[model samples]
Target chain A: MKGFLLQGKNLSRLRGRLKSALLVRIAVYLLLVDLAFVFAYPFLYMMVTSLKSPQDVRDITVNWLPSGLHWNNYRLSFSLLGYPSALARTVLVVGGCTLGHLFSCSFVGYGFARFSFRGKSLFFLLLLLSIIVPVQTIIVPEYIFFSGAGFLGTYLPMMVPSWLGFGLSGGLFIFIFRLFYISLPRSLEEAAGIDGCGAVSTFFRIALPASRSSVMVCLVLSLVWHWNDYFEPLIYITQQKKYLLPMLLPGLYRIMGGMQDASLSGGDALGDIYTEAVAMAATFLVVLPLLIAYLFLQKKFVQGVERSGITGE
Target chain B: MKLSYSQKRRWSGYVFLLPWLVGAAFFLVYPFVFSIALSVSDLENNNFTKMFFVGLANYKKAFVTDVEFVPKFLTVVTDTLINTPMIVIFAFLTAIMVSRDIKGKGIFRALFFLPVLLGTGFVMQQLQGQSIQSGSLEVARGILLPEKLQAYLGYEITGYITAFFNRITIVMWGSGVQIVIMLAGIQSIAPALYEVARVDGATEWEMFWKITLPMSAPILLLCIVYTIAASFTGSSQVVDYIISLAFGTAVPQFAYSAAMGWIYFLFVLAVILLVFLMMRRPVNRVAQR
Candidate 1:
């Protein structure tokens, strides 16, 4: 009604209002663009700088666009970092973790959602506490325990926890899953009971399929978290062959340059430019798969977040 | 006593929770207990094959005699306190904007949330720290205060501002989850309430303050907690100090490191508990009112 009236009775005012609204919209868009650039420029710089030739990267002026793709930077990184093997190792670790979280955390979530057993609330509180306490606080002794048990230098510390449903962010995943499960109708359980289904069977057959969206959320989160995990691997896995991409990233400049020189982007001198490009290249390699996966799975991820928010469970 | 049907059903719940229970016992509980023991004991070995029980000596050393632990942890805490408001405000404001009927909102959301997909944990800290320092130092230097203001504020404040500008991108990047949560909070508000507000001639600003903000109080509290917890996480200086105390030196004083960790953990726990207590009262009052 306001718009219709403004269109005729206050035509001049409508023009002024439309102009102001347009100006405001343009300003908002500009702000958003600035923010997006701020968020994106780091990775964008990584990709662009990696492709720059040695001379192009080292020049005094900042050049955002590379002259050409320096696929050699990737080739060098691929060979130097043992990219194939490391990528496979990461995949194995991350894959195992996602599976572990999907099955085990969901099982735990089902228990929390369905049960009113003695000490259930206490156990749940403990679960919440686990999420709050910094794992770093316990790492001193935990690391010692692992090394003492000869579990250090292997994937045991990282993988074993996941297998047992206590992996990185496991508490949160279980919480999410429990929220999802509790939202299910009580009639489903009764129906399953009438159909001669046990709790385990019912969960496997009914609840698991029903909570597919949450499961996807857990899978993507677990996969992404495990894939990008640098610290745990840094602590536990000492073997060069076992190092994930991130752990290898800091060392790439050193390995590629074969010099005890400073970090990759040393004083704007030309000497370190090639290594800087190589470092960016190595970073690109590490994050490429994640970027691709996010591009594909972003819809599902957003949906999951929306659902979780709506329930606020 | 013989169990009834409901009793059996209740007991069977434990069977389902057995894996997480056992994992929690070993992973979190046992490690926590071990941390307490290691903190109190007199252990100077790298691995813990050799140790002697000494009551609170490690804690005493960390708390009383330590040249670095308390101050270093406090520095991290201070850093967090300064940065938390900016991150949360940025997240909340951006979320409200994106939630409004706007063009290309999905694109904006995806762009804002890109950080969560890529940057997390130590990798993010290193990437952000190194990238910003080396790549953008010259750009940051352009924003230096004039001579008079710089002199008055001193290098301490001026230098902090410069460094904070360098860190601003990374800090904003940390708000991805918070933004999403707040966005969800906004969307979950009933549209009927908005319609009613519009009928009553409520301005957007008024509606935001009176309705949207108060309605999302629970989520805002969650975001604050997340921000606090995430601040202590990653490669924060506190964690670095603890790690260095345990592993950086030749003779790793595991017990001393454990003490430092416990102290830092207690400090973080206290901050979170305070936030909960502070937020809870207002929420309770709102409920009563």
Candidate 2:
């Protein structure tokens, strides 16, 4: 009877401890949610303000919530931004850049990881230096070179270097692939080699399949960078029709500013000046594809990011 | 192994390296040498034509005569000093918190990472209006919170407090990439260390300082380098000033802009190298010990 009583007391004590721990965990969870809200508030505000009417947006006091959703803002934004053409151009540039980087960087990475040769260390050091050196210093010469090649105003200047595996090597993609290749088992390759497979075949049959996660990681990063890139397209493509999304949005903003000048003579000037709400809608349209891509690929993207050791490696 | 076959295989390795060798020679090495040459030359007749070599004259003009150089450079430096510490600390703390068991961890990671995807230029423009407006809004709201408390504290204390506030906002905006990096670092650490600490009856705070901090040093260095690089590359103030000087209505000159870029590049290079050397020593010691 005494033993049973001791057991009951001990059980009660354990239950109390478990309840307190659960409470602590809940508190931590709430704190994390609050922290995320703090960080995300600006983006939410931007989205909300975008939905507000021009008059509402321009008010001296900021409104935390829109009075009502303005759907026409989006239609106006599309026409005002010339967003269709911009979207097409952006897709072309990003797609072309992605393909170029994948082909060129993968080949180069394969070569470095698999081969042993003279000047290999020296070549790797040069690659590292390429990463360290700021691209700004080289922009002038690159512009001059591209102009001389008659590749200016075309997507070639942006897309072709990636094909040559030029700027892509210095990025973490190369290192990640290299490390991944190092960790891969060599017996598969050895067996293939013994079966009369060529180097290219071995790479295709064995290494390529093994590095899918790394490849996905590279693709996502390349797409993001290329999509967001404003400066290169700005410098190279002076033609408004060929401008990518980033360039196009800023150009639209500029055009909007011009239209805002009531002194303009054209009949179309007033029509071209989008409402403030429309401008916000236009911003959303510009970023929509990226957001869509992020939504679908978020799982693979996170996995790839976690595996790439981007912060740690 | 047969000696003859080994020799043939070794020679084939050189053949495999041919593409990268050609690429480096044409793209990297050539441009590096050409940059040095271009930096010294003078542009004539609308930037399409070039004149004779000007030696260190361009560098001299940037350092000695350029009006905007010093102020822009100072702004960059000041911003870097303000922004980097907050980012590093917040990233570290977030990593610690997220590393623990929690619900919706993935969503939290995504939230932190979303801003990095927004890129610098867009984010800066968004911040430009919001930051200015928010300052006024806060004042109008008459919130007697941190700012009021700081004012009551001495002037130096107030300055530090304001500085802290500026950094926190910057950090909150910029934490995406840093948080992702820190998360990877935290994940890479063997869980066994934590388990060992728990066995030793170590407190959470003690374990964090003793184990987490030391193990995370490599990643911390990477974060510092990335943050610094991102700051210079992404600063809208720098970009706007330079672009205006380069292509703006006021002096549309390529040579002057090139000169300024070279100067900025040199300064950044010096700082990066110094930091690299300092960071490298600790990593080496850690490896040795």
Best by lDDT: 1
Evaluate fnat for each of the predicted models and list the values in order.
Answer: 0.61, 0.35
Flag clash pairs in model 1.
none
By how many angstroms RMSD does model 1 differ from the true structure? Answer: 4.1
For candidate 2, give the lDDT: 0.69
Q: Across residues B1-289, which tens digit of lDDT does each residue of candidate 1 receive?
A: 9987698789879999999988888788889999898887875444466667898887888768987777887789888998888888889989988887888988988898777767674335545666445653332444334658868888788777767666677677888878977887778778988899989989767998988887777777778887988788666777977787666788777787888888888888899899999899655644463
Residue A29, candidate 1: alpha-carbon lDDT: 85
Poorest 10 consecutive residues by lDDT, candidate 1 chain A: A256-265
Runs in model 2 with CA error above 4 Å?
A1-27, A167-170, A255-273, A309-313, B1-27, B46-49, B121-124, B132-163, B239-252, B285-289
Expressed as tens digits, the lDDT of each residue in B108-226 for candidate 2 is: 87777666566543534655455455553221222223656756786776555554555565677777777876877788778888999999979677998988888877788778877
The global Cα lDDT (0 to 1) of model 1 is: 0.77
Per residue, candidate 1 scores C-alpha lDDT tens digits across A143-193 of: 767877899888878877887678688887888788778877779877997
Superposed model 1: Cα runs more than 4 Å off = A1-24, A254-274, A309-313, B1-3, B44-50, B121-123, B130-164, B282-289
TM-score per model over all chains: 0.89, 0.86
